[model samples]
Target chain A: MNAKLLEIEGLSAGYGAVPVLRGIALHVAAGEIVTLVGSNGAGKTTLLRAISRTLASRGRIRFDGRDLGALSPEAVFALGLVQVPEGRQLFARMSVEENLQMGAYLRRDAAGIARSFERVYRLFPVLFERRRQKAGSLSGGEQQMCAMGRALMAAPRLLVVDEMSLGLAPVVVDQLLGVLAEIRGEGVTILLVEQDVFAAFSVADRGYVLETGRIVREGKVSELAADPEVRRAYLGVAEAG
Target chain B: MLFAQILVNGVLLGGLYGLMALGMALVWGVLNIVNLAHGALIMLGGYAVYFLFTGAGIDPFAALPMAMTGMFCFGYLLQRLLLNLIVRSALLNTLLISFGLDVVLTYVAQWAFTADFRAINPSYAGANITLAGITVPLARLAAFAVALLLAGLLWLLLNRTRLGRAIRATAQNLVAARLYGVEPRQLYAVTFGIGAALAGAAGGLYGVVAQITPYVGTSLTAKSFVIAIIGGLDNPLSVVLGGLVIGIAESAASLYLGPTYADVISFGLLVLILVARPARSLRMA
Candidate 1:
């Protein structure tokens, strides 16, 4: 209903020579939290990589009305788009505070950086407490929080998060999902690739079910949640459509 | 007493050597370029200051910044026009391209400078100050101090400044770097230029205490690699300590064995250290 913030038409992509995503189409509305739900090897991560231009892709991806096919990964990032990649790829050698500072690398306004630093610290107070310690030393849950915080430091208009709940305890996942909801509330759009079905579906407004690089199901959260086939195959529920 | 004197001398020399490696380390750490030609740039810096002092009648120390500025431009253009092409391609490509540049520069230096071993002989060159029976040559001490000062400045830049933070981010991931809204290509060139400027400063100081020739690059490069690796590309302080280790090792070898054996000793240590900590050394680097 909102003007489309991102639109993909017949987008095809792959790593190396093998094609993973075959002419997939998807969309995300402005200021909306869209969850791309899929199982392992379902091209969820690959699609994000394609959107971020980290992997080579074909077809048209228009983000905020700009052609994304021609942009380099760095160029895509410069357009206020940031991704919290799989496995929380924080710079392990850097301190927690330094890692967050790195996210603001493209920014020049010192006052804004200081403000964002405080905001991230407020979101994850544990990070503020351990800001001086090396990022590698943090617990897994903390690292995920830090990864999201690092992405936030970039002041992204659209945050593409891949597997934020992966390897995280349920409690930690709930906390991160809650914070993400708050970040989205503050006008940061999110494209979440979630493996945890319940956690993702609970917060998402729109949902797309990716199966082997194609969108097999697309609808409002309530529609997809009640779709018997989606529940049976993806949601692990004993229901038939 | 003799061992103490040797150790002190080694540390002084090591400080300068560490300074020499600092540029290579920075470039390698941030830019991810091995920059086999780094020592050649250092040699050029020495020659620049040498010519400025002799031809233009400028004081060598005062002309140090001038030489560094020139070298920075040279490095910036080199990266923009040449190194940038293959920087995103592969490690082997960068290594090969930089080595080619090194050879080209070395040959050009030989043709232009005529293989002369030039040293900057300022009025304070021979002066020495002694404290508690330890004599420190004025030129060497001044060079050592300059080296430490530069290292401190580099540390502050990486840890305290915004440009330094961006450079570190580029070092980690270019995608993340771009998201922060910085142009990576220009950032890379700037980072390379800074590395070259550091090398130029080291070279100017180096000419004060040592001899320079077109051939000086090879040894300095080997030494720089050793220090950069042993220091582990993460911290500037590690590089200084790395330089100190090599300096002490070289001095001990020269004093205990023959002077020629010092090369063997340092290289031997370099090989042993690299071989021993293979994974840990590279991961941080």
Candidate 2:
């Protein structure tokens, strides 16, 4: 098995005094696509925020064997743990190219940035086409692509994507899934937080079922898909009556 | 011919007015800090330039960079140490804090430099150039030229540089900025520093064109607020255009209704704009 890239232990986080995530322990191995599937309001975003250090949390989040507890969000990003946040928070007024440029903001490596730009363009040709257009002007799917493309521009080791399929057409979601596979093939481990369980299982090698901030199930995607409880709750397969 | 001359004067003065608003607009847009202390920073810049010219024997124009540098450091430390602590607080809190800062700065200036009006009188202070039928004071023209030049430079800094990209990104989405490895506190400090430097430049030029007193800050701050509202906060050139609008309006008011009505006209225009375009002004804010 690959070594763990991101390991969390007994993590608790929330907004103000309201606790959202409680004692959640999970890990993602290097170069693996791990999906955390949960319904709406299941604290998926909260967990992601905790990892990004945007939300205050009490827990140990170790990335690549280093403790993330003391580090700032930017420091976490500098360590190659980048997040494509929920709701596609693109700099609305900036052009697509400028948004991409912001992704590589910390890198002083001009040649590498140029290469990343090429790679992002190659991955999302539509983004290259609309490079000069404002990010706010893009379609919902395009915005998601731009967000992902922006994260990819950072050359992240572990890309934590929150709801890639949100507000996207099924065809676009499928296309994004294919791209996620391609990204994983490029040796970038992924932690995909998704509301669409089936779509996530399609791309993810491993799956964790989180409900109300706790991980209730974890197994191979195939195993989880075949599980009777998961089928009943998530896949909407009615029991034989 | 008289009207044309008045228009020329207004245009010349408008450039400086726009320069004064540039810093306020920038800090407002980026840090979401209305920066009531902005005028005080400008006032301090005027004093710095005044002392540099008088005490160090440097030309007032030559002293601009030094004043700007000093103000930049002051702004950097101000934002880094003090403003950062309460940046995420309520807007009213920030407003009160900044207003208090403005008062403190004004009192300090009064204590240190006295309330006496001091104007920078270089050898060419009275020099004027007649173009066709209009007379343009050399110092005002130089101030106008410098203002436009600085605005252009600010535009370049924001559009052409990597640091500029980070700043714009932070202004749009702080989370996205942090996710892309931007330390927002540092970025905020730098942005505030740049804003302060612009104010410093404008202050120095204002001293060249007009009198400087400790009490000059309040009206200048009000004027800057009005201009920033008229000009959308995002674009540098637009802010200057806003300044021009105010400058022309004030000059025309003084011409037709006598000099004392200048403030009345400018504030009246502000009221009209706010009443007419409430949505745009709110969005700009």
Best by DockQ: 2
lDDT of each: 0.87, 0.92
Instruction: Write down the lDDT that model 1 would get.
Output: 0.87
Residues B1-285 of candidate 2: C-alpha lDDT, one tens digit per residue: 999988999999999999999999999998898989889999999999999988988999999999999999999999999899777568888899899999999999999999999999999999999999799999999999999999999999998999998888888898788778888899899999999999999999999999999989999999999899988888999999999999999999998999999989888988898999988775742
Q: After superposition, how far is residue B40 of candidate 2 from its true place, in Å?
A: 1.6
Per-residue lDDT of model 1, residues B5-85, tens digit only: 898899999999899999998888877889899999999999999999888988888998899899899889988998888
The docking category that best describes candidate 2 is: high
Top-lDDT structure, candidate number: 2
iRMSD (Å), candidate 1: 2.6
Tens-digit per-residue lDDT, A70-158, candidate 1? 89877888787788988887877678998898888767799998989988998899999999998889999999988989989988888
True contacts kept of 2: 0.97
**Which residue pairs in candidate 1 have backbone atoms (N, alpha carbon, C) closer than 3 angstroms, thus clashing?**
A106-B180
lDDT of 1 at A1: 40
